[model samples]
Target chain A: MSLAHKGLPFDRNRVSFKEIPKLENGYSAKVPIIRDEDKLIADSFAIALYLEDRYPDRPSLFKGEGGRAMARFVEGWSQMIIHPFINVVILMPVHDLLDTPNQAYFRESREKIFGRTLEDVAATRDAKREAFTASLEPIRKTLLSQPFIGGESPLFADYIVFGAFQWVRVLTSYKLFDAGDPVQDWFERCLDLHGGVAREIKAAA
Target chain B: MSLAHKGLPFDRNRVSFKEIPKLENGYSAKVPIIRDEDKLIADSFAIALYLEDRYPDRPSLFKGEGGRAMARFVEGWSQMIIHPFINVVILMPVHDLLDTPNQAYFRESREKIFGRTLEDVAATRDAKREAFTASLEPIRKTLLSQPFIGGESPLFADYIVFGAFQWVRVLTSYKLFDAGDPVQDWFERCLDLHGGVAREIKAAA
Candidate 1:
């Protein structure tokens, strides 16, 4: 979305967790590693800063320095608040979509990290769903006052959050927001951005 | 903290929920309403904006337009994320500090809003405490990477979050953080700001 917002087009490269790409900086793993000719950048936040600095004439991922800091705050909020909840909700479904070996790798890694089976994590989703929805209150309230978290149009902050929802959308049919929710309206607005790039993706059943 | 950051000093007025002062805009309630000679501003956020624009020469509460927008994001996060959790933990203790009449008003109003007695809310603190701490992960992670949410010295974003912790501090000695927690270090640093204005306040206990 940040790349799209900046009107930069690039070929998509899909590297599964099972495969590691050898890159400079001695870092071989991470989905968001972007190779701009000889420049290799990893981490979404770092990439955002790189893009903003490298493409100064393009539409900004961050509006300015302050926006940059606040975007980091939102990134933190998404990491701590939104991602964990969504991860639990979609864990089993995501594993189901992986190949047999990939599924085994996913389960083993996740179970070691969580100290619980993926099935057990999915089992708690029904009980935990309300907390997940309630966690979105900050975003819901912000959308009430502004058209976007970026104020008038979608900014990097919007993409920071929308990425999580997009992940959930691709892997699960779960509806995280209720009808008439302000957040639902904003989510629809996000999906509609960049000529419906996100909207065109089909959900996994 | 923001007012101090701007190097502004003025009188302090304490109004209980029971008493409201009438003003020019026919808006009478809410604490933190500041009177700048002839101007009256309600709401901490509005006051911050007003101060920034009105006194641009002073130390900035927000660094720039992007900072302003991000500060609002922090404000939203504080309102929805921190305030609600802190409110639940300190509700009973806060009620305990009120005088007889005010205590009656507090209990009646809160019970009606929460749909439960104050005791019931307090009872859940043991179970809810972990979630409250978990919610601070964003702030904790940010503090790990930056000295302040504003990047260096404290900014309005820092105050937006610190205000909630300040509330918790004055009302209860509940020890919200474990020893050596990053958040605890930040909280201590916040207290030490503005010549320790927040630190000097006496706890209700």
Candidate 2:
């Protein structure tokens, strides 16, 4: 999204859970390792900083000064609260998409993080739905005035939060937010950005 | 703090709970009302926006793009979590400072907000302290990489969070943060800002 937001054309390299650790000749054990010319940057927030510094001429990811720092706070909030909830939600849908070895790897790893078996976690998703929506107080309150977290237009902070929302949207058809929710409205607006790239990236069949 | 952050000079107008509604001939019934020439801004966040817009030649309250929006997010997060916690914390200490009529107004209004008697709320202070600290996860995680929430220097976002902390600091000597906690370090850094004006303001006897 940051690259696309910057108008930088790139190729998508899809790798399953098992393939992530084997990338870049043992350079990283993580996915999202971006190779820009000779520069290989990994991790989303690190990549945001790298892009901001390297592509000063490009459209900014963190527009304005307090942007990067506040973006970090947004990332922290989304990662700690929102992303964990989505992780529990996407478990089964993701497992269904994985090949056997990857599925095994996925369940074992994800169960450790969630501290619950996939079936057990899925059992409570219905009850947890409202809790997830209620937890969006900060973001919901933020959009009460501004059109985006980055103010008039989307910024890196918007992408950080949208990544969490988009993660759930691409998986199950389940409703994470109620109809007419400001966050849901923001998500739709986000999907409409970058020439509808977010919508163009089709959800799993 | 926003005024101080922008290097603007101001006089403090301390109003009692009962006296607040009388400010500016009932123009606003709120504390933190700023009378900047002809502009009478009521809310804290609104005052911040007013200051930023009115004093463009001054040091920027929000240094870069996405700043105002991200600051709103920071304000939302702090108000929802931190400020409410401090409001509960300072209930008794604030009550202690008021005279008879003001004390009656304070207790009645605050009790309505908390939905509990002051004594009942005071009884749970020790238990709630750790919970308040636990809620600082986003701010703590942000401080892990950057020195301040707005990056190298403190911005309105830092002051938004610090306002809550400072409220507690002024009314009581009770330690809100544990020693050597990253938040404590950040609070001290905030205290040291603008020639230690936060410290010079003095704490309750």
- Real contacts recovered, all predictions: 0.57, 0.75
Best by lDDT: 2
Per-prediction TM-score, chain B alone? 0.93, 0.95
For model 2, what share of native contacts is present? 0.75
Q: Identify the CAPRI category of the predicted complex in candidate 2.
A: medium
* Candidate number of the best TM-score: 2
- What TM-score goes with each of the models? 0.89, 0.94
Model 1, range A12-127, lDDT digits (tens) per residue? 77656676544445475766888788888888888888899999999887776667777777888999888888889789888987899889989999999889999998898789
Specify the highest-DockQ model's number.
Answer: 2
DockQ of each: 0.59, 0.78
lDDT of 1 at A112: 96
Candidate 2 per-residue lDDT, tens place, B1-205, comes to: 8888889899997778888888898988777888878878888888888888888898887887688889989987887888777877888898998999998988898789889999898878888888788878898889987899999888889988898889888999888998879999999999999989899979766
Please give the distance, in angstroms, between residue A127's alpha carbon in candidate 1 and its true position after superposition.
3.0
- Candidate 1 regions with alpha-carbon error over 4 angstroms: A21-26, B21-26, B88-93, B203-205
> Residue A77: error of model 1 in Å?
2.0
In model 2, where do residues sit more than 4 Å from their true spots?
Answer: none
